[model samples]
Target: MPGPPTIFVARQPIFDRRAAVHGYELLFRGSAENRFTGGDVESASAINIEQSTAAFGLDALVGERLAFVNLSRGALLQEFYRMLPSERTVIELLESVHGDAEVLEACRELKRRGYRLALDDFTDAPHSQPLLAYADIVKVDLRQTPEALTPGFTSRLRGKRLSLVAEKVETPQEHRRAMAAGYDLFQGYYFCQPEMIETRDLAPSQLSQMRFLAEVSRSEVSFEQLEELFRRDVAMTLRLLRYLNSAAFGWRHEIRSVGHALMLMGVRPLRKWAMMMGFLRLAGDKPHELAITALTRARFAEQLGPPAGLEHHDSELFLTGILSTAEAMLGRSLRDVLTALAVPDMVRTALLDGGSRLGAVLRIVMAYERGDWPTVESVRTECAVDERALTDAYVSSLQWAETSAAA
Candidate 1:
């Protein structure tokens, strides 16, 4: 028999009106073709449904929130969704699934069994009525629906005891429009894009963190220098001591001073933790997912370095990944954000121009995050990395980020 098929999976956050993650839409493709072809969708969906409900489990993808799984007509009729938990799974029907009698009855049965149904890329087509009547959620594709018609289109879907989700919202303006249009949930990269308004100067604490990051980014920074930086910032000092004493570190003795903590963690490990803390500090009051994404990308890129022939520059690769979202957190352009801090030439080039090998690694990490498998495949080949290695790195990074963020 053939070995188990490769499953490429990525998740996009679904946010509530308050910008909190409500769930995630799991995006997956059976192969690198990037689009559903032949029996790929059905076969992949079946394997995922089984794995998500058992074995690996949904906790690997989403801790405890709902999982929105796409279902083609064949999967719906064949009851592949039955393998998933009704209360925690949202069966999202593809647009190609018509409201024929068979599908309508299948959706009705799903509702009676307590599974919430969602209509994907909804545009009020003639064949939508049968399935629409049973849907608990309707996703409006903002890219296709147009801003001028958003409110009117969403208004008709409201007050029917169903939530309206704004899909493909890519900017702050689109996010605001979706909110004004009464979309209860949002899905896209709006939160990851910088708000295009008057950029505020970095706060004193933020500035201090950036300076600390700059100092630590160097491979030769003295521990005393790092400790002095921590000593100047009372909050950083307290955070460092507290982190070392925290249960995650399992220290039998309390770590009372910044110097002792820095020495104990050593140079390389200290650099990693300190940089991550700095990123979290820069994240400030943004949604928690931003920090998580930064951590995930950082780890993912760091792991890719060895495979991509940049083994000696893992630290810079990690820096490149973490700073990838600086613009989103700082509310400034990427160039402005990078200018405020010091980074190596490779990192700067990767962030600014994507013209280096480090840039290629960053691109692969990003494409993998968005489930843009075609780009991922091309970039992976361009970087000369094994596909399985990339998949393992991403999966491990996701788990690591969750634990790291929680700690």
Candidate 2:
């Protein structure tokens, strides 16, 4: 009745291809007092804008690392985009929006202001003609359509412009079908699956960032010195604060700089966060969904912590587990990925081979997600954490994330 309290980004088999996750759609469900909106379309229309938009923004800002949400054409017409951060998100025009002059013009204006636009479930329609001019990405629903018809339809629309994005892609086969059909972007569950390809190069900026963070985290630098290190990288500095001030940080006041962040975040948490920051740096958003999923996994692993003393090994465990989907993230080999980044050999073994204590901890984290209580229990016994303790940790962490954190 309440729908899900939240829509979780389903993390699955990391597929063997390259795709950037621009943003995700947030489909809504009504409050207890309100009538339900049937179908993702009419349901999208049934809302009171001021209430739901604010709620969605507040919820997303608090819970996620920047995500893109869908706004109904009516919502879009109302200029809901004005209220949210334009760069960090994309305004999706639901398939239900008619391709017409007013809508198209409004879309152009949003684009002019630096907002990204996504066209959903496109087919060869006269209405879509105008919309595609300004649409940055096209989301094709694979749940209802097969691949055979994609090429002609997409070719007619794409014609040297716009990337065709295959959405609702749920399996490895679906991924293959979409890729073969020339879909420039992909979304779905294939990220969890093992693929034959090796790793690829991350953007130069991303590489430089991870290298910098790795050096900073490992340096004999003081908190004061750490401030200078972050200052050297403006984007990284902003992200660290955003992540810190986010509901994720569990802090008490406004944090102004890297040194302040270090003092509040502490050495262990700082190291864990620095590695996470490193991962984000290494994987600067090219394969967007994979990046988001990896971010989730890293956050999950960080919250779960590592087994005591393989000696400062938990941070490495967090790094490895976050990268478990490396193959799917970049459609390449795990070994190749490590080599490209020059990741240490120890991390290479734990992440790719899935050997060692770190690997075992990762196994438990995955098992916990699958609701495999017994396997979780086995790992818990091995790690010296009891079931109750693990449950408590999860609850406390969620509360901390939801309430005390400020970045």
User: Among these predicted structures, which one has the highest lDDT?
Assistant: 1
TM-score, candidate number 2: 0.39
Q: What CA root-mean-square deviation does each model show from the true structure?
A: 19.0, 19.7
lDDT tens digits by residue: candidate 1, 61-160: 6767888998877567646575456778898998888999989988888899789999999876789877878999998888877642356677678867
- Once fitted onto the true fold, the runs of candidate 1 whose alpha carbons sit more than 4 angstroms away are 1-6, 31-39, 147-149, 192-407
Q: What Cα-based lDDT does every candidate model obtain?
A: 0.71, 0.54
* Residue 197 lDDT (model 2): 18
lDDT of 2 by residue, 232-342 (tens): 656556555554554423445977657887677565445434433344234433322333444444445555554333546545655665567666644567777677765
Clashes of each: 0, 26
- Which whole-number lDDT from 0 to 100 does residue 332 have in model 2? 68
Candidate 2: misplaced stretches above 4 Å? 1-16, 19-22, 31-66, 146-150, 189-407
Candidate 2 global lDDT: 0.54
